[model samples]
Target: MEMVYANRMTMQTIKSSTQDQNPPTSPGDQHSDSGVVKDTMAKRSTLSETVNQLQTNYSSLKAERDELLTNYSSLKAERDELLTNYSSLKAERDELLRQLGSKVEICEDLFALQIFISMFHNFWIGLTDSNEEGTWKWVNGTTLTT
Candidate 1:
């Protein structure tokens, strides 16, 4: 094992043993398991930009849905219109909604993936002290046998 990792494990052992005598000071640090580091402001700005883009897309999609609804109602009112026209228009509207549904699902999946990756990276931050830092342990309370 690397000296750094070994030292960190030793500190963790000492800290855990002494927890009853002294309470931990802080919850944990913000460093993540990911090798990449991000500045707080840059992360915030990226999130803000993503949110703004999503809002714009939502508004656009909403307007399109509303327009389809208006057309459907107006077509329904025209009782003389051929059944084929109504059916075709309804199909188009359904297709639009289905496409939008898939897009939303994709976005949701991507967001969940991002959150999972972040959580996975940071999960070990709390179990060890700073002196023996950069060591990763399984997040579950059980100690590893190996």
Candidate 2:
């Protein structure tokens, strides 16, 4: 019957496939296969160690980046605070100068004074306005006329 023939053919095919999976090998082939397996295992171990080392390095770098970012934020905050304080001091100085009605005077006299002070440590000035602003006076308390 056809059923009996089909069953016989299936059994033969199964046996053939099984033989292919576990074919008889020479001693040489066995030794070569063993060597290939050992080599593959060694390569796998090296690759695994490399991957672990890379992961550790990546973690350290990430931590360093985070620390640097934190420091940058702190520095930025300090700079902003300093700027705010500087602005406040500048405003206060302007207000005080305004209240005193004393404006900063820039003229050749200032430059001359700087040169004279650099040249000498202690000296009496020939002309000054210490008694009153814009009213030049001599050290003998005599007012200078233009």
Q: How does each model score on TM-score?
A: 0.30, 0.50
lDDT of each: 0.63, 0.80
lDDT of 2 by residue, 73-100 (tens): 9999999999999999989988998997
Tens digit per residue, CA lDDT, model 1, 1-146: 65544588898898777746444444443334222444666788999999999999999999999999999999887865667788889788779979865221122355776776665543322244333465544344434233
- Measured with C-alpha atoms, the lDDT of residue 48 in candidate 1 is 100
Clash counts per candidate, in order, are 1, 0
- For model 2, what is the C-alpha lDDT against the true structure? 0.80
